[model samples]
Target: MKVAALDIDGTLYPGALGLQLLQALTANGISDKSKSEDVFKVVEKYHFNEIDFQTMATSAYTLFAEAIAGISQAVMQCIARQVWQQERTKLFPFVPKLIDILNSQGYSLVLISGSPDEIVCCLAEEFGISKYQGSIFATHQGKYTGKVNLLSGSLGKKYSIFLQMIKDWRVNLEESLAIGDSITDTALLQ
Candidate 1:
């Protein structure tokens, strides 16, 4: 049950593309531009208060989820993939070395992200991470299907999938480590 979880946005990468995207949306004069700023404001408010990582992460997730709700899955995937490829320039310097070390030590590595699966998968591969885990809320066939599948977020991220991984691999949590840079990951770390 040696598990290690890594957060994608600020934890893995240096800059916040999510916030940048929000700014872009506002600059472009997209409808309801203020909503984007409001989300960032919420995030900033939490950060200013020195909120715990889990709470901050949850708030960030909520912001993203709300903003992405009405968008089509295809568009969401495109946006996520594009942002990851174009906007992100640097990752934590220790990420690659740490993953290798953890793998050698027989610790299972899990990349849990609130970002879309398409984006997270790309990052995992780029970082040479062998396995991937995370959630993307999306629809199919260019329709806004109300139901969203959990690619790897919230409870599914912290417990369900992690537990299943342990059960399938016959490992124990005592030997596991979860690493993340957000408040949302507090649950997984605990």
Candidate 2:
């Protein structure tokens, strides 16, 4: 099968889903607002092109993971839905058109993001894309265990996931296309 590997942050949408989820958690008092300020600062730097994608992504992921270390699965899911509702309307005009074009061309769309699985699932559902991957947090007793899977499917882990996807899905590399806004997308693009 031919594939269209897609990135969500800055590719499909204007902002980061992880950040939106983090903000929602903090707003709901699940995480401390003071702790989130640093993550936001890094994001601001990223927005101004002051830092490369890798650095910004790493910093944001670290901060977000630390903040949501103990949240329950149910709570995270509820907040993820709320985030999706708010972010759905802010997608780039090109995204829908691009998806349609790719679909018509027989490219199987696959979303790979650095955001949490909950939010990634929401995005996949919104776009009707079945095959996707995102950060997988470790949990114990239905709560976050302060640990993330080594293969979280974004940033440093993206290439491995992309390779696995290619193998599993039997993707035709010559006929496939990849779109992303950062160095994180290098593996898929390459």
Candidate 3:
């Protein structure tokens, strides 16, 4: 199948959705005040050009990993759904039209995101994308182990994950397309 890798945060939505996920996690109590402070500081540094985007991403992901450790996937999924429902109105109007056109053309849509798997999967299902991949929080039995198995933002990680999916699904990259924004998406876009 020809693949279309779509980034969720900015491409699918009119603006960035990263903070919405963070807010959901915080509201659900997966993240504490210290973690919030740390992530905010990273954002501040990135905004001030004191640190590169990679550093900001790594720091934010680290804080997220620490905050979400040991939480059940079910709980996270619930929070993800709630967040989506609340923010659904903010989604860009053209995204669905684009998805329809892509679908009609037989492109296999995959939502590849640095966001949590819960949010990515929920959004994928809502948008009728059958496949997706996102940062995986380690799970043991039914509960989170609080460890990140693969981070989408880590250097080369997004490309590796997409490459594996391409191989496993027998996707044709020569006929595929990737849509994304931000330097974090450079690997996937390439």
CA lDDT, every model vs. true structure = 0.62, 0.82, 0.78
Worst 10 residues of 3 by lDDT: 13-22
Which sections of candidate 2 miss by over 4 Å? Answer: 45-55, 150-156
Q: For model 2, which pairs clash?
A: none
Candidate 2 residue 161 C-alpha distance from true site, Å: 0.7
Ten residues in sequence with the least summed lDDT for candidate 1: 23-32
Q: Each candidate's TM vs. the true structure? A: 0.69, 0.89, 0.89
Error of 1 at 182 (Å): 3.9
What are the clash counts of all predictions, listed in order?
16, 0, 1
Model 1, position 55, has a per-residue lDDT of 66
lDDT, candidate 1, 1-190, per-residue tens: 4767677777877766556554544554431455566667767776698665456656665555555555555555555566667665667788778878888887767676665565777777776666666654445566434334663545435555556655667667676777776555677778
Sliding window of 10 residues with minimal summed lDDT for model 2? 147-156
* For every candidate, C-alpha RMSD to the true structure in Å: 4.0, 2.2, 1.9
* lDDT per residue (tens digit) for residues 36-153 in model 2: 7788988889889999877877777677666777889899999999999999889998888898899999999888898788998998998899988888878889988766664353
